[model samples]
Target: MSHDLFLAAKAAMKNAHAPYSKFPVGAAIRTTDGRIFSGCNVEIASYPEGWCAETTALGHYVTGGGGEIAEIAVIAERMAKVTPCGGCRQRLAEFAPAEAKVYLCDDAGVVGTVTMGELLPYGFKGGILKK
Candidate 1:
């Protein structure tokens, strides 16, 4: 099942439009109910205006009707281990629980898996917004 998520990410990487950076990235997330959402990095000339793969996938998750994320998979071309950036880590926390499994893929299958809590141990979340 985890490998299925990685395959989805790898397939999404083919759609990345990163001309300037040439560093295409793909991400896939499994919703709590078993649906898989995938996205690839979309780059723009402005650099900062581009969106990461995870955010793209998360956008789909939101528009497709929000739900908890059960697992996440990420893949890059050359990186041996491609983990989500700080922004993605926090974004994932919005849907995934602290113990949600994350898969970082390389060329083979799932290279490693870590919990969301391990990814962002001290993250500041909207829990603070209640006040």
Candidate 2:
């Protein structure tokens, strides 16, 4: 199951628009309801406007009526493991539980797996925004 998710991430990587960095990345997420969404990094001319693959995938999931990510997989570069960036980690923490599995992979295959909590300990939740 997760293997397939990783493959989806890899497939999405093919569509990345990273002309500047040349570091393409892809991300896939499986919802608790069993739906899957995948996205590739999109780099814009303005560097600050570029979006990470994980963030794009999450946007797709939400747009498609998915909620509560059961698991996620990220694939990038052939030689080294690439995990989601700090902002992506925070975005993921919003939908994934503390114990949700996050697979880190490269072109070869999955190199590591970590829980959402491991990536972002004490992540901010909705409670923090209550006024």
Best by TM-score: 1
Q: What C-alpha lDDT do the candidate models reach, one value each? A: 0.90, 0.89
Best by lDDT: 1
Q: What TM-score would each prediction reach against the true structure?
A: 0.96, 0.94
lDDT (Cα, tens digit) per residue for candidate 1, span 41-114: 99999986799999999998888887878899999986867999999999999888998999989978798999
Residue 36 alpha-carbon offset, candidate 1, angstroms: 0.6
Candidate 2, TM-score vs. the true structure? 0.94
State residue 104's C-alpha deviation in candidate 2, in Å: 0.6
How many clashing residue pairs appear in each of the predictions shown? 0, 0
- Model 2 stretches astray by more than 4 angstroms: none
Clashing residue pairs, candidate 2? none
